[model samples]
Target: MAATNNQDLESKIATEVGHADVYDEKAAISDFKADAIEAENAEHNMTVLQAVRAYPMASFWAFVMSCTIIMESYDVFLMGNFVALPAFRNKFGVPYPGHKDYIIETKWQQALQVSGQLGALIGVFLAGPLTSRIGYRWATLTGLMLLNIFIFSMYYAESLPVMFVSQLLEGVPWGIFIANAPAYCSEIVPIQLRAPCTQMLQMFWAIGSIIVNGVAYNYNSLDSDIAYKVPIALQWMFPTPLMVLIFLAPESPWWLTRKGRFEDAAKAVERLGRKSAVNSTETVSMMRRVIDMEKSVKKPNHLELFKGTDLRRTLIVCGVYAAQNLTGNLIANQAVYFFQQAGVDNELAFALGLITSALQMVFVMLSWILTTYYGRRDIYLWGSFANFVLLIALGIAGSTGTNNAASLAQASLGLIVSVLFTLGPAPASWVIIGETSAIRLRPLTTGMGRATYYIVEIPCIFLASYMLNPTGGNLGGKCGYVWGGTAFICLAVAWWGLPEMKDRSYREIDIMFKRKIPAREWKKTEIDVNDDE
Candidate 1:
């Protein structure tokens, strides 16, 4: 009678979670979920080395998928760098009075920048449902394939309109990459490795920037169109290699478990980890246990992102990602262009951009070191505060003069901002975006959060184009004033709402949010990882 009653309770839970298929097997399953939870607790308690020994392949694949950002970043930075090259300007721009080089008009520049972001926004929303239906590996593969087709538009376009549409359509696949890459990486790795794995997005962001800027700097003097076309064609190399590799990658065990493919989930866990070190069957049960517990907490739908405790989670993610756009990411990305407008010569500006990208690679690793010791909240808050201060200084210097003295000061300041941003808030934001969302709804939540990034970025891009363009507002270095104000606002919000989630398990995170604890209390509150409840 006791056994029957226990089965009845589980049946009720399955029914409540709307998993009728699971409810049908409740009698046969017994109480293995408790054992699953216990297994998860033990694994969570594993040392970093042990976890790595167990799941090296998982780590590799996480990094491999996260590198999808490299393609998108390369494309974005390519567009920004190409504008400084005479070949690009001659191909797509009109001559301006008193200027030695042809220039893209402010309206056309804004149109090109805005079109990609708009297309990205469209793709970001679509990625959620598409990933839901097809799963991560294939969804990612589809986006990779789409990128191949879109490159034709960019490479062959003889007119601005064609380039505009190319950028717009290319954004769709990039948007898919932005939404899924980090979120997917967060899922495959053990919690201990989550921060580093997901933060690879930033590490690769620097790499992509470095490669594209390097290409532009070396080829800037070329009198032929190949200077720009070669960079555009390089984009084609990314999709094919990624597609083949993604085809061989393991599916997210969590996604497999969600689809009632418990056996397949077990196989994935086995495949993801070392055969000797991992118990695949037990691992899948642990995933099911967490997934089911989350399912009981809330429905896994887009609407749930705005409801209950999830609303807070949603807001935190959106704020974290949005914070980047406001904090001079716009300036760093267009450093070459911004440097020119600040009075530096074209070649030197592009040269400085290459150096900036290389430094960010070093600083991004420093962020990892800091994240390990200090925690996400401190990194984000302090990093953002530093940017707030530096951008203000930059604005002040920009107001000092328009000569070489002022230009060099602003350029030096911008480099510091870029390096520091990478080491702190930039990487911190990616980690937070992965950890802060409700686990069951993370893919959609991550998509929505990244969507917020582009949404905020659109206007910043518009304003940035105006600030740098001689044809528009032409604020040049003084645009720092505008960004500094926004950075401070973001910094204030982080202090009031961001939580330190260092070394947290998903189950612990779910309970803390469900209890509605204050964000600052996340550090003080103790969560028992072993507690099955």
Candidate 2:
């Protein structure tokens, strides 16, 4: 009698959630949403490492997928060093005596870098429809092909205007690639591996930055234009092989389900792993269940992103990524420039830049190991707290004047902040965004989240430029106060707003949101995936 009563209660909840019968599409969609607990239980049953060992091909392909963002990293680090190089700056910049050779006029420096960001913003917006319509493989191929072409143009350019145009065009591919890569990784992999796999993209990005820094450190002093052009041309090496690999990659099963090609979706899953513990039948049914449930709720649209509980998620994701920008990241991004602006020479600045990149790469690797063992929210909060203290110290050091002691203090502070950021906010931001959105609108929401993030960063970018430039505000290390305040706000947001989602599947996340559980409570809440009611 008790079991019968429990079944009745569960049936009522299913009906309220829009449960339908197995053969009927309406019944399937409704029933799946109503009973998402079972699916969630199945999805997250295995540990991430176990999942990887069970399906090696999935892990291999995810590694390949992570490589897609190397260009963005390559562009940022290479450009940072470019502005510091005398040979390249001499071609388009006004000569300055106190500085190394020349400084690109403050306005042009802002425009050249902002142009890439603006183009990236546009590319992210376009990526949603492009990937949705053409599929992930083709969309990625399109971006990679176009990115290589733009790099060639930038390399051959003779004037500032031509170079600026190339940079803007160059950002389009990067934007598209960035928006899609995380979504692709999330969709293709199992739930346990989702956060770590998405984060591997950041690791690849760090590797790219390390490579560019090494190249610039060695080649920046060359006598001819070849010095700059060689680094730009080096970007050409990544796309061709990526293009070939992506051609052989399987289409996302979720994408196939979105198109109602259930058979093809099953085949794609089979291709991902033929004899894994998660056989094709079980995985395909789960996909259909969740996919149909989402369709019953609504189409995957950006407007729905702001509706009800989803609004909480959108804000959290947007805040985390935006905080990533505001939390003194630009300082690290423009390290070579900021280091030179202080008392450091160009050679040491380049060397320090290389060290910063290498440390971040190491920390990123550490983040991978740590993320496997820790929760995202804790790492993010702890990291924010550390930055708050470090940035305050940085500001205090800068206020002491530019004596040798103060300069050394400021440089030491910058290096420390670099390590803390990679461990905390840098890797955490991307992982949180990857897990925050609903699976159906994952691409649209991720794109929207990143696009808004870059928008907030535009003003921050301008501020970093003004303070770092000699002829401008020239605040140098003192600019730490401004970003320090923002980091404090980010810390508070992490404490109050960020939820703990270490190993929760999308279904569990949905259930939690539906119950309106407080962010802080998520770590301790025991979700009963097999509950009858």
Candidate 3:
């Protein structure tokens, strides 16, 4: 009996030892996988961050792009402000109430607005094919030349019609640059930093407005023809340096790829990536992957933007850009003129314009910071909502004939709204433009989107002029109501339809929206290489 009991105890101890060994092996395997995953995640995060940080060349390219865009912003604001410039009005022979030669009535103002828009429409429509054929770099250079020629021509114009023709020619370059610059910035930067870099374009636009107003104010005070002539002549100086500088810069890698120059494209990509002087296998592999991916994708045509697979993307982009233009932000560009109509002095009004533009620049930078952490949808919703409220307040203040103090208060509130708007949709919209479409489709779609934007903008420009006419009697406030309504529509679209793009790769974004990949399973999915290559 004692021997049998000892045998049972020995057997039980052996069984327990066997189970312990099995558990240890399993635990070791699990720990190894966790470590591997953590390492991979860290490496991936580092790679993305490094790519973003090493984008100064791309940023420089973007800055050059912005210089041309700054001209556009300068032209828009300067034209509006020039309406009130004593030299401009006097040379054009705009009549006062008792004067005989006063042909500068509301109708002429409306006509000038229409003429600019008509030229813009034609120019925007022409930009798509021109950009595709000549590349954005050349297109930008050509547009800059045209812009300078026309802007300088305005200085010699003796009549309103000649000046009108100058503005009309100016619109062509204006339309082309607007469509091209955002596309250039989007293509140059890595996916994660797209929004911030694009927002930098907006930053310069605000700078341009400020500079225009500042120069105009100083020029307005001078008694000589040099006042108007110098400011207008200075427009020629704006884009020539940038065009010459960018001419020295390399063309976009993506554009090279599109033209089937793979080797050159790879070198361009390497330069942009700023890889070490000693090339590594990993850098070569990464660039080859980008090139191979470009080769595999079907290239998009301009007409295909309105057709199957890309139609939804096209519509969303168009709607967003249109809303951007129509939301009355451009009206704010003319804010000094608006205040002047409300009885503010020219110096005080220009001062207020400078303040508003400065605030816009500040908020655009702040918005760039927010975009790094938050989802695009959240920013768009909150920003548009704030803009909605502020527009209502401004409209109310306008309708009630508020005093200078009250107007200042309303303007302050409007500045806050502008800040929020910049923080939200303004920057995000550019990001969405890049993210939503296939790589091949991006340029054409961006052009189409911008075309729609400018098309919608033309009507809004004229409408704002008509509304703000003192004789229009409360229509200006009513236009603000329209802007508020547009903001509301944008909010609804954002909540129900907008996809979350934060932290997603361009490939991941394409898969999610274009391929209908389920949100829950997206993390588990991987892109598979096609064996055909």
Candidate 4:
């Protein structure tokens, strides 16, 4: 479902100055197809409240699939938190250099972190092809089944090597979960609901993180293996119930349409929205029109992502994800430790970390308000600019001697950086990644896009370690300067690169990209292809 850069499409642009330009019909849509497109467009153009009222099930189903992301968040936090657990360290560690306390080796921490990411990378690359082959419903089921089994290994593992293997295996299903949740939401919901639904993924992620932080804190003092095991056991809360939900939830209509399962697609549409508000058959026809519009020589291959307008789309999508780490969000991840390094007491630092995690959830919900009123491009741009400013301020705060005044300033700025991050780049990234990705190449494009997190993450983790270590850069909050510098570069790239995808439907977006519309001019440039009956 790919084509080379559509020079023909560019030539077809009627030399118009603004969006009101009309194109002569090259082909006409029949009343049946026209009704379908128009009906869907009517829904697409609905207000957020109108859309939600119209399609309540859309939100429910999106939430059903997104629950796994919460689990992914909790699981990642649990692994990272293990190094601090008294029981976990005693069970998995050796004598420290100068104390009776046990310590998990630095090498093991790094190894486990890298290996989990590697497994996730493998699963991400596999998700596109696997979902393409099996369809979203079955692929999700398959992932759930694997997750249930994999948890066993994690729960029972007695050694670091065995636990490392468990984490490696566990990441695969989580990766698939990551790759699928947003795409499914994008497809099922109308354009009005799409951004909010996908952005909600981050809210769920923060919820999981907060839960695990609480769980780890409560359990860490335990002198038994249950400290870690209970947290790992909590993961079971997701897969089994979700398996039931997947069985009950309708399949993605987009995937159904692509498979040429038209009748089933119509039924799935019926299942996802109110029957009175939705015309299932007409909606199915809309999917057909879009699929036909995007179809090209043979079925879509992953290589198509690199050819034509898709290459630009892929780069923008990847940049949205990688920008998360580049913009000093990592500093947010280490908030408690950074606070301690800034001279805050451990109790206060941990309390601040809890507040930071909770605020992250609040900020994600705040993104819904921002996107509802503003464009995705603006949120990203302003978000990046804000982060750049904050990082520079943080660096300056850090430059002063590590006194209470400077430390408090650094800690305060860092917390703002974290919560504000969720409001801007973190959630906006999902919206852009969900909205801007080529729909036909969505699974593959999204998979590759999500993979960039791990790709950017590995090096960032290594560098953050060195930069923060007492014997290394010892840069403290000055680390913000390095990330802020990168944020500046990313902000520039995003400014010159990101397009406004506020509320455009897939068909409208496809047409604009086909005609090679200028990035900055997307809001001003509009075209209507008359599908005359």
User: Would you estimate the TM-scores of all the predictions?
Assistant: 0.93, 0.91, 0.82, 0.90
lDDT of 4 by residue, 1-533 (tens): 12434665564553452333332232244665676667667775788998898889989999888787886777766665676566887888878765455866656756665667777888888899988888777778888999999999989998899988988898898789888888888899888888888888999888987987787667756889788889989889888999998989998999999888999998988888898888887788778887888886667678988998999899988988899889998776666656766777655666777788899999999899898679788988998899999999999999998788998998899899988999988888888888887768988998998899889987886677567644346688898889999999999999898999887777778888888888899988765644311
- lDDT-wise, the better of 1 and 2 is 1
The C-alpha RMSD of each candidate to the native structure, in angstroms, is 5.5, 6.6, 11.9, 8.9
Total clashes in model 4, counting residue pairs 3 or more apart in sequence or in different chains: 2
TM-score of candidate 2 relative to the true fold? 0.91
Who wins the lDDT comparison?
1
In order, the Cα lDDT scores of the candidates are 0.86, 0.81, 0.67, 0.81
- In model 4, which runs have C-alpha deviations exceeding 4 angstroms? 1-29, 93-103, 529-533
User: Regarding lDDT, does 1 or 3 come out ahead?
Assistant: 1
> On residues 1-533, what C-alpha lDDT tens digit does candidate 3 reach at each position?
99999999999999999999999998965554444334223323643357565655776777777677777777677777776666666666456664332334565565665566566666767777788788888888888788767776677877778778887888888778777777778776665567677777778788788888888878876656777777777777777898788787667766776676767766765666566521223332333343444353545577777776567778877877887876667666676666666556778877777777787788878888777667566776777777888777767766666567766655555555555666677877766666666556666777788778777877777677777765344254445676777777777776666666666644445545556554335445564422111
Stronger candidate by TM-score (2 vs 3):
2
Off by over 4 Å in 1: 1-31, 296-299, 530-533
Per model, state how many residue pairs clash. Answer: 0, 6, 1, 2
Worst 10 residues of 3 by lDDT: 277-286
Error of 2 at 122 (Å): 0.6
Clashing pairs in 4: 1-300, 19-526
Ranking by TM-score: 1, 2, 4, 3
Error at 91, model 3, angstroms: 3.1
Candidate order, lDDT descending:
1, 4, 2, 3
